[model samples]
Target chain A: MNLYDIATKLDASILTPKLDLSRQVHCAYGADLLSDVLAFTRPSTLLLTGLINIQVVRTAEMAELGGIVVVRGKPVHRSLQELACACKIPLLRTRMTMFESCGRLYQSGIKPCIKDPGCECNVCPSV
Target chain B: MSAPLCKKEFFVQEFDFEHAGKAASDMRKLLMDYGFDQQIVRRLAIAAYEAEMNMVIHGFGGTLIMEINFEYIELVAKDNGPGISDLKLAMQEGFSTASDEIREIGFGAGMGLPNIKRCVNFLGIETKPGQGTVVTMRVDLGPDAI
Candidate 1:
């Protein structure tokens, strides 16, 4: 799905709509642990996170994630927004819980960002 | 002719959450501008950011240096006093020494060093208790660098 579709499915408000929302996201990774996200996530994947901080944005930037969906309606810090804009990564906020957001996206055909046993993408550890 | 070795240094302050990953971001941009492969650039950026954050969260801040040659990209993060007491323990996954405050901001998961090691071609650490610590990470460039 694209960023706009994911936004609609989750009822999320785009915090950085000024940035492009037409990018395709084939996979999604949901995690609040910045370390885990950095370690396991793939490029251009959508990130579902509950945390809002500079590090979160930085994680998205370093990982080259396509977009971010903040769950549970957490108020995003201004610095986070500014950095998101600077990094050009779309930021979305949803009132739904992380579980709900993940479920809705998964049910809509968004695959989990899991590394299969036969995967050779050295970044992610074997499942 | 081989490209000249390029180097840049950034100073990170302890608890400076405001600009924690600036160095890493800047280094990534520099490497990209130099025409490095996307995969190599991303791997170097991840390792650089982890090293930079390690200084901000664990040590008394430090200087992060990025050196790029035709063959490899190297990142050297040197921090001030309060070095690692046990290198072996620090290298293990899920072995962070960060406090509650750091954890609340979505860091300190004890995966920094391991993450760096995974992203880089070589990882090295030198520390002296009550002195300081230096972490050196390198990612090779070329066809098989990825």
Candidate 2:
């Protein structure tokens, strides 16, 4: 789904510049653990989490995640937003809890990206 | 252009959770500029970030020294804090000593050291209780390795 569609579905607000909402989100990962997310998420997967910290942005950048959706109406701190902007990763906020957001996205046909064969260990997959 | 060999140092403050990943991010950029392959750079970045996180959350404070050469990139993180008493337990996938506060920040999942080991070619750890710990990680950058 596109960014616009995701924002509308989750009732999320864009915290970064309105760039090409046309970016394709092939998969979604809903987790607050940056390490798990880093270990699991494939490049370009949208990240859904309740954590609102600078490390989130840093993890997104390192993993080359497509975008980040903060759940439970969690506010994205300004510094994080700035980092997101600097990294060109979209940041959004939603009042919906993580479970609801994941369910909604799954119901909408977004699936988890295929895990890298190298990541078949105990690490959580980005699905 | 031929790849550039370089070394840089980063000082991580004790419990400075706010800026933990900055050093790794900077190092990643430097590796990119040195013309390292994207996959190599990404692996190095992940390893470096994990090491940096350990410094902030577990080591109390430390220095991360990174050296990038043509064949490999090496990260040496040294810290002065209560050291890891049981290396075997610490290397376990689900063993963590991080406080509740660190867990709340979405870390302390016990994957930091393991992930670093998984992403790099060589991983070494040295620790003395009440003194500190030093972790050395190397990522091979040759074509076959990538």
Candidate 3:
């Protein structure tokens, strides 16, 4: 799905500055731990988390994540938004909880970016 | 090792979660300025940030000393605090001693040591209870390693 579809589906606001909504989002990761996300996530995956801090932006930059979806209707700070703008990472706010957001994306054909071929997540069909 | 091409020292205040990743970010910039490869730079940045956050979350105020060479980069984090008793367990993926408050800030998922190990070519940890912990990590940029 594209950013526009996700925003429309979840009633999310495009918090990043001047993003192209047509960018395709292939997979999504739902986690609050930046370290875990950095360790496991692949590039261009949309990150869904409840953690509202500056490190979210930094983690997205380090992992080369496509965008950030803040769950639970939390308001992102201006500093984080500015950093997202500077990093060219699209940031969005969603009223849906993390589980709900993940479920919606999964039902919409988005999967997790699993690097390991032997992993057994249903969305990740054996790499 | 010889003298580093560039060496930077940072003092990380104890229990300061807000400014934990600054040193790592600075190191990333330095590596990029030195024309390091993007993969190497990313690995070093991730490893450095994990180590730096560990120091902040677990150790007391400490020093992050970075040495960048033409062929590789080395990050040495030394802190004086209550040290880890079980190095093996500490290296586990889901083992964390970070408090609830730290968890709320999007860390303490018990991936620090494992993530650092994953991102570096070589990682060494030395800790003695009540003394300190010294984590030395190196990422080589040679043709054979990459």
Candidate 4:
């Protein structure tokens, strides 16, 4: 689904609405550590995490992630927003904790990136 | 897909998480504009960003040098001091010695080297504690090139 749909489902606020919120996301990868995210994330997926730094945006850009969802009411830096704008990806914020947001997205048919869905990996919120 | 096209260098500073991925993003943008495949550019960017982070988090900051050719993309990162004591251990996933300050920013998971290795076809690292580290990563375009 698109960012607008995902944001509505998770009670998230879109930070970059002009970023073509119409981009579809097949799955979501939730991780605070970028290494795990890089290893496990699928292209065109969304990145869910509590980290709100420039590197996280960089990781999303590298992984070609569809967008970013910052959980737990974290404040996003201006540089981060600029990076997202330059990268042409949407960034969203939610008062929802990482686990809760992932659970919400997962229940909405947005499974993890594992090829065989439900393959038991911790990267995607299976809780 | 086999000719040297362009080169650029990005300077990174220790504890400078604010601008960690600038080089990678710029490089990826240039490659994408040059018509490289998304996958290739992404792979190159991942490795490049990881190496640059290592430089900032572990050493006295350094330069991320990117050399792009038709056949491959090469990333060379050279830092000035406080090199890794053991590369073998550093290469292991989840092995990290990042300070608490670095970890506070959510980056010290010890996956830097491993992640870099994962994205590149060839990886080389040389370092000595108290001196510095130099890393070289290469992603081959493979046998099929348009």
> TM-score of chain B, per candidate?
0.93, 0.92, 0.92, 0.90
Kept native contacts, as fractions per model, are: 0.83, 0.61, 0.50, 0.72
What is the lDDT for B61 in model 2?
81
Candidate 1 structure quality by residue, lDDT tens digits, A17-42: 68999999989999988989999888
| TM-score, cand. 3 | 0.86
Per-model lDDT: 0.89, 0.85, 0.82, 0.82
Off by over 4 Å in 4: A116-127, B1-3, B143-146
lDDT of 1 by residue, B1-146 (tens): 57648879988999899899998999888877877778888898899899889899888899999887777888899999599999999999988889999988888899899999999889999999999999999887877543
Candidate 4 on A35-115: residue-level lDDT in tens? 777777867889999988787888888888899999998998887888798888799999999989999999998978775
Quick one: ranking by lDDT, best first?
1, 2, 3, 4
Q: Residues B1-146, candidate 4, lDDT per residue (tens digit)?
A: 45567788888887677777777778878778877766777778778888878887777789888887767788899998688888899999888998877776778888888878877788998888888898999888755532
Please give the ranking of all candidate structures by TM-score, highest first, separated by commas.
Answer: 1, 2, 4, 3
Residue ranges of candidate 2 with Cα displaced over 4 Å = A116-127, B1-4, B144-146
Q: List the DockQ of the predictions in order.
A: 0.87, 0.57, 0.41, 0.53
Candidate 2, residue A10: Cα displacement in angstroms equals 1.7
Interface RMSD of 4: 3.8
Error of 1 at B28 (Å): 0.9
**Model 1 misplaced stretches (Cα beyond 4 Å):** A116-121, B1-4, B144-146
DockQ pick, better of 1 and 4: 1
Best by lDDT: 1
